[model samples]
Target: MFRLLIDADSFPLGKGPMVMLILFLISTIFIFARSEEQGQKLEFWIFANTHFEEYQTRVPIFEAENPGVNVQLINFGGTMHDKLLAAMLSNFGAPDLVEVEITSIGRFLKGAIDEVGFVDLRPRLESEGWMEKLVVSRFTPWSYRGRIYGIPHDLHPVVLLYRDDLFKAAGVEMTEVETWDDFIAAGKKATRDLDGDGTVDQHAIVLDRRTESDYFSLLLQQGGGFFDEEGNVIIDSELAIETLEFFVSLFNEHKIATPVYGTWHGDPSNFAAMQDGKILSILAPDWYVGILKSQVPQMAGKWKAISMPAWKPGDRRTTTRGGTMIGITTQCKNPDRAWELLKFTYFDRGGLVNRYETTRIIPPLKSAWDAPIFKEPDLYLGGQPLGELFIELAPDLPPRYQNPYWSEGADLLNDAIFAAVTEKQTSREALTELAAKVRALIAKDQGRWRDL
Candidate 1:
């Protein structure tokens, strides 16, 4: 049998070695004890590197202000939602907080409102008066059945990004363009055979034929969407048919728009087309500003933003596109602490301003709009106050409802649009078939989730 002595003078081993071992054990224990006492380990899962970086800068401030709190920021990239959805269903391995993109939010909103995996934020928003402080319509994508489950991260107000140089050279007056009709008239003049190659070399606008989001934006701009505020399918409504017809006409009849070699946002060819003066204008959301600056820096001072051409003389001039929301999960053990972190990251003015400065994304917090950064002129847009221009359209930004079937609905709508544009089916026929498919999906989803 071996015996250990705590008395240094009577120790069997050397006093120095015993003392060192004791110190190491004590330090190890102390470290673990301190970690336990640190309180509330909040795991925040984000998919975007930019968002992860932005929150990393703010986490230390939050930890310092609220002592003994720790935040673990994880960037899971594109597979985040799938992993999150799996965790939610299994009731295991879920993060304390998560950032859900607009397209992915609907998947988290299945079943009854109470059955949602994310905590319902409506009561807090109302009690704290945050509902009024933020852009009201910005909340629509994060809410279900009047219950908001997340805080909006951006306004995403859509605007027309036009080549001012091209418009001026083509003798088009932008101010006189109030409607889509006016826009098409201007496109006729702007679309020209600059190289005299017999075929028109320059198109007035860029609309991605492969992506449904472009058509969705036009639908939203005209006060139409896949689902109405009441959660009913409206993809085949008269307004939607009209919007789809106009979308098809842009490429088929007018021939003023062309699809880029790849996606409007990612492809190098799109930037080359812009540089070569082949594409004149694009419908850009606030976040697209960062993309343009990073991709086509040479187009500085040549581009200018304007309100989107309305469908009619007095219709809404802007629509919304991409958005993100941050929410606390129902699985969080320390929900109050999680909410504090969420509020600090999203509701606090300094955090919002820092996000805008870093990402060039317009915050939904209306109070933060008055920040000097928002008022500054963007050199890339010919010294135009780009932030102010987006803000101007923010109020009129239309609401985009959340439906559990939005993902499937969007794919079906894409197919419908493709059929119409390819002349295989009329716009009405395409949309009516799309509407039937969506209704069937809704019925199937309802049957699966009886509480919905």
Candidate 2:
């Protein structure tokens, strides 16, 4: 009984119109059904392009394995943490998962642990035996009040990257340089005035007077840090004072290290210095290998890695530096699914292998250390099985703790280092002042959080 009208004309409904309507109905149903099949869409945010690319390759596999789930990766670069923080504060438009750099993680943990913007993954980590599988110390930077909030991405163990050719030519036997004393003695021999000028041209090491990383590395190597295991401010600890004095003495007293030109990583000037043989060695973490390979590819086979010299024999020769963690936001509606994706990306063996191959970054997963990819010789480092060396040093890496004011504390420590190194203040005086300032900041933070 249906009819159709056009302008002033009217006609009985035809089979063609009926067929068209039927097809439209079928197409609408099919569209919605396909949409339903697409299911949960997870928004993941990352700051690093390398990390983003790694996830892009794995997302398709995850989608195929998990029906009805899709992942959208967004790389916000340097603004990622700022945007994530704003979303967390405003409770709007947040990604289900995000990568938090170690330095930025402290800001998110300022509040009570239960109220943090990221989900507390401690239960899942313990229930699934992830705690045992991954290196425990790596979790420290991503945890607060004993509750872990993120999965560690890398081990980042520090090692000595030295010019093997230079050392051999200088007759400095690296094998005998097991302690800092021996290293200092060898460094004196390696330091030379290559151009016959009164000023020294080649130095044993590169120390950045402006940056905090090298200082932190040496401090952590000696079991000293800004805070104790109990989270108390210990910037002025006797151990820390000694470490600062020693760090300063490297350039001021020993005169064996050259001031870093720009930065030890990623800077063209530093790469040029290395290429020109102006510096003999650098304290590098696992991640630095990629930088060296990519930036100074011509240095292949000329450089080598060795365990860092200990303060004394029998001490830990490795220290941890920079790191990253992947975490699910508290705003995630389906934390279970997000957790699955997180585990797949960071914890799964296949995913870890893909990540290692892509980044050359040693995974915090202890079991993944034995992968064949890790055993393969690196031609860049004189065919050394660099991953194997990192694995040997992994268990001994010192733990680095996190506090809400960590960034501020680090800045203050840098200022203290500059003061002492420039003779504006003695190391003890500078560190003592720094400890007081850090304590005051911690107290202020406690009061603000208590109010919240």
How many collisions per candidate? 0, 0
Write the residue-wise lDDT of candidate 1 on 168-222 in tens digits.
8999977678899999999999999987779888899998776687899999998
Clashing pairs in 2: none
Off by over 4 Å in 1: 1-39, 447-451
lDDT, candidate 2, 115-179, per-residue tens = 78988999999888889998998888998887888899898998898988898788997767898
Cα TM-score per model: 0.91, 0.90
What TM-score would candidate 1 get against the native? Answer: 0.91
Top of the candidates by lDDT? 1
Cα deviation in Å at residue 305, candidate 2? 0.9
| Model 2 regions lying over 4 Å from their true place | 1-39, 447-452
* Backbone clashes counted, model 1: 0
